[model samples]
Target: MNIKQSIAIIALLAATVWFWQTQPARPAPRVSFKTIKGANITPADLKGKPVLVTFWATDCPGCIEEIPHLIELHRQYSQAGLTIIAVAMHYDPPNHVLAMAEAKQLPYAVALDPSGSLAQNFGNVQLTPTTFLLDRNGRIVMQKVGVFDLRDMRQRLQAID
Candidate 1:
């Protein structure tokens, strides 16, 4: 090949690599855990329904602040095929999580990630209130790192419905 053609091919390859690297991350990773309610929760179980997976810690004020909204969302969309799973961080005491779950009367499934495996699967979640919204096909449509916008989340859930 000519020198000019070789350079052109190299340029194309560089562009391709850049594009690939800059692409957004894939949807939620596939993993399963048993909820505190003694039920197994997994991506497959949530198929055909929109799901909101939230990682939280009992000591996190922001996480605590979002509980009511989450409860409301659960009540509002569960019948419309929305599933909400709150996973407590590994550092959180299981008893504390259970007590909180009971005291709050949480309406949805609550799981304790004592191994943090579930959090790592969802991008090494190290912050409380980290959340992922997945569509009916199990593809993550949104990922919030901190406190999320309740109105915005509601709208997104409605869109999937």
Candidate 2:
């Protein structure tokens, strides 16, 4: 390669290394909530377990569409140290959230974030169906803002399991 080409390649490599070294690690947020069943739930409650925290709203079409997938994931992984919690957004009416939870018969714990405290804890989650996957050590391993791939999510959960 020419000297100029070599110099450019070296600069590119340096930039890549710098970027990787400087990027801050994202740790999972410490979150706690009260389930609709009046049971208090927290990350501490599921220590050593891989957890999926999903923020959703009753009015969100995407959120509704993802419910079945979430339910399936919970069923397949709950026995393998996977904990899934569905948190209803504050904008969604509490009654509606409760009614939908019952109608859907969600197999996992369903919580209502009435004051948005839990949402705020997770980077002020404003988008419906925002999901966070936490590792067994409670680290934020992945965050999906919209629709997420179920297969990919399953693979990650399997790794943590």
Candidate 3:
């Protein structure tokens, strides 16, 4: 094969890999949330709304750093049918979670996964600061494992009706 042909084949393979990585979104998992205020929010109640679900821990620096951004997201999008749920990992102490939520004045629901079932339900999430962005139809459009891109999130939020 010629040099140019080899390069072209490599490029085509790379493109195909990238395309497969962005598979079609899957339906939201069947998990319920118990907010710190003792309110229960089921997947049924969250339908027809753009939902941002984050698995976080009090001790995770990345998770803590994302708090302000999450709060702002809630403030800006809550009225427009956006539901942000911060699910605290079962390993985190409830007292620490409550204190963090209160200290930060988090505007969104802070759910506690006391048994880690919620995390398992959300694809056995084991990393802190993992985020799932769901469309209005309850299909997860994005699942990010680290710090999420703010601009991307804003653009996604704008499309929800």
Candidate 4:
């Protein structure tokens, strides 16, 4: 094959690998979430329900954009045993997170990771809007680092539920 054709094939392969689902074999980490409303949550506490833990910062535009969608998802699936947690990054000030959560009227739990230990436990997540979708068994079935497809998420939730 010519050089250009070979490069195109390599690029296609790279894209396939990049977009592949990341289904971690390990069970959900023994992490704890301290919600802004003074609620304590542990992974064990969320057993038998699907959970979405999104690592985001108040200053991240993408994160801000997804707030509405996240809220919608929670409203639709919460009664069906889906638990969503929006975790503010360690760098995001608590006041800013609280204000934004209140302004948006987030129905899901809003958590703070001040020590960044929660991020560290979740594969050292450093990117804003990194989301992990866990099954009822606490196994990570999906890990998306950017904007996730709403339709795809809904389908996955249905299958898991």
The best candidate by TM-score is: 4
Evaluated at residue 13, the lDDT of candidate 3 is 85
- Report the lDDT tens digits of candidate 4 across residue range 110-131: 9999999999999898888898
Off by over 4 Å in 3: 1-21
Ranked candidates, highest TM-score first: 4, 3, 1, 2
Query: Which scores better on lDDT, 1 or 2?
Result: 1
- Error at 114, model 1, angstroms: 0.8
Go through the candidates in order and give each one's C-alpha lDDT: 0.88, 0.86, 0.90, 0.89
Alpha-carbon shift of residue 71 in model 2 (angstroms):
0.8
Instruction: Judge candidate 3 at residue 8 and give its lDDT.
Output: 100
TM-score of each: 0.83, 0.83, 0.85, 0.88
Q: Candidate 4: TM-score?
A: 0.88
Model 1 poorest ten-residue lDDT run: 17-26
Residues 7-32 of candidate 1: C-alpha lDDT, one tens digit per residue: 99999988885564344546668888
lDDT tens digits by residue: candidate 3, 1-161? 99999999999988884564365899889788999999999988998899999999999999998998898899898988899999999999999999999998998999999999999988899998999989998998877777777888898789766
Model 3 accuracy (lDDT, Cα): 0.90
Give RMSD to native, each candidate.
Answer: 9.0, 7.4, 5.2, 3.2
